[model samples]
Target: MGADTITRTNRVTALAPWLLVLPATMAVFALLAVPVGSTLAESFSNPLGVFENYRRFFASDYNRMVVLRSFWIAFATTAIALAAGFFAAYLIAGSGPRTKRILILLSVFPLLTGVVVRSFGWMVILGRNGILNNALIELGLINAPLSLLFNQGAVLVGMVYLFLPLMILSLVGVLETIDQDLYSAAESLGSSPFGVFRQVTFPLALPGMVVGSILVFTGSLATFVTPRLLGGERQMTLATLLHEKAIISFDWEAANTIATIMIVLTALSLVALGMLAKRLSPKGRA
Candidate 1:
């Protein structure tokens, strides 16, 4: 009887927090769940009131390529951002207080600005008459103007620029939490600065890098604003195609299918990251 009573008490304790969370949970169900359910339903629903949209996507090569490009672009963007952000984050982490603050501020400055404004900045920097081409011309580096805008190169640059902040912030959180003693110990044993970083700093920073890469990858995968503004016809990502399907072509079914694929990939990546972290945690502790 006493054990039953204690179980009841624990159940009530758990229920109390859930009761407080009920309203927020209800709102999430209404907002996120409803749209996602609708999309899932639509993905399996045919335009003619049957389930054919999904079949069509799987059957179409053009769509397969478009979706593949989206995933590829996102993967590439994430890798480059992670590589750059890791070094940048490490440099900032080892800096003094004031310098760290300045570096953090500089990292987030791009994120503070509006997306449209950033797109325009890319336009100015990569245009035919842009500063880079003009400087090259003046230096007699090339007789003809180099085309940088409206190409794969422009799309990648813009994607990396936009996604870099997420990487830096993710890395900063993990880097900040690391014990300085580890580095000191490594150095005391005669490890060079770069060697210490390679052995100690890099391993410790892996979790953050993994997290940041996932963020950048997901953002780049579903990227719409940056790619559309920066890329030409050859640079159409899955997101652009989805947008076109929904808005221009009025093909919501195709759009929903694309969205479903993106969601699945993102969820899988997060799950993979979780499993990886679990595997790595024990090694660090041991």
Candidate 2:
């Protein structure tokens, strides 16, 4: 074979992998990059000016409050989900295969149901005239039903319920990967159960916790249905506000602005979580 031919063959072999991924890369660019770019462009192209939408977003106390509230809720949900998922995953990790399978199934079964269905189920449980209230009333717990639905607490409950399963699943994989010998060695070294978990298990599981936190935080920030249903008109997060602007008020410019802000915030948060995870991992520490 000619030297030129061999060089061309080598180039083609190197390019083959890129060619295989070209379609997927194009698909992502089309579906995500293009729309996001368009939205950002439209958000800046308002007749009034580029900064007008942003000024409006921060000028109002209500908008500021809503943005802060959204971050707070996302943080709270991520924390709760991680704590709950870690314990659940630890139990599953230590269990026999049959029990582990059953636990995993139960943990992830809610994911099979649609989000709308799950939100409605929460509505039934949390509504004032719903099942819990009715049962409480029947038991003479209170004369009048306490307002349970259409509030921040209700929204938090729904958010936690929605994201907890994802947290559990993320944690399970990490926990399962941990070596059993490590636990035995720790025990042999006279480490208590709590000490072993605190030093070994928890550190090893930090990556999974970070992954779960990223997922839950991002989802909680952008979730519309749960907040809309459970929080009603009282609480308006960024996602709901974006929906209102685009669909109800027909203000695409403002909607685009909010969307852009959300995208940036989500990206920043995920990056921070990734950095934190790396710092906490054994390899990162090393």
Candidate 3:
């Protein structure tokens, strides 16, 4: 074949995969991109003008507090999930096949239940006349209900419960990928359990931790049903505020602006998280 023919063939081969995925890519674009683009356009085309919705978002004290509160809840949920999930993942990683299967099934059972169902379940357990209050009263622990169902604390509990499985599953995959030989080698080198984990296992698992953190944080940030149900009207996060704006107030422009801000923040967080993961990797350290 001529050089031109060879080059054309090479180009065609390189393009083949893209060709194969083109249909699915177009479907995704239609489903996700179109809606997002429409929302963005609507936000800019509001009566006050292109930047008006965003101006209100930034300039309003209530809007600013909602943004800050959303991030704060997400951060707290991510931290709590990571702390609990790391140990659970380690246990599952080292467990026998049957034990691992059972643990994983149990961990993921909550996901099978709808978020509304789970939130209601929490309400049943945490409400003033709920199970916890009844138990406490019987035990003489307190005379009155502790008011656990309509605050940030309840939201934290619900969010942590919701996202812990993701963290555990992500960490478990990473932990399982670490060669068993590495642990044996560390042990042969007189490393204790703590030393092996701190020096060898943790460094290798940092990527998973980073992945779990991002997932939990983003999930928490965007969750509306749980926060709204559990925190009631007392707490206002971005997601809940967006819901109120779009549904209750019929303020499409404001809602679209909030959605755009969330998408941008989520994208920025993913990039920053990926960079942080690279920095914490063994190769990055070396």
- Per lDDT, the best of the predicted structures is 3
- Which rank order by TM-score, best down to worst? 2, 3, 1
- Per-residue error for 165 in candidate 3, Å, reads 0.7
Backbone-clash count (model 3): 0
State each model's CA lDDT, in order. Answer: 0.84, 0.90, 0.91
Model 3, residue pairs in steric clash: none
Per-residue lDDT tens digits for candidate 1, residues 169-261, read: 899888999998988899999999999978887778888877887788877887788888888567788878878889999988788888888
Which portions of model 3 miss their true places by more than 4 Å? 1-26, 46-49
Worst 10 residues of 1 by lDDT: 277-286
TM-score of 2: 0.90
Cα deviation of 201, candidate 3, in Å: 1.2
Give the distance in Å from residue 265's predicted Cα in candidate 1 to where it truly belongs.
1.5
Q: Comparing 1 and 3 by lDDT, which wins?
A: 3
> How many angstroms is residue 252 displaced in model 3 relative to the true structure, after the best TM-score fit?
1.4
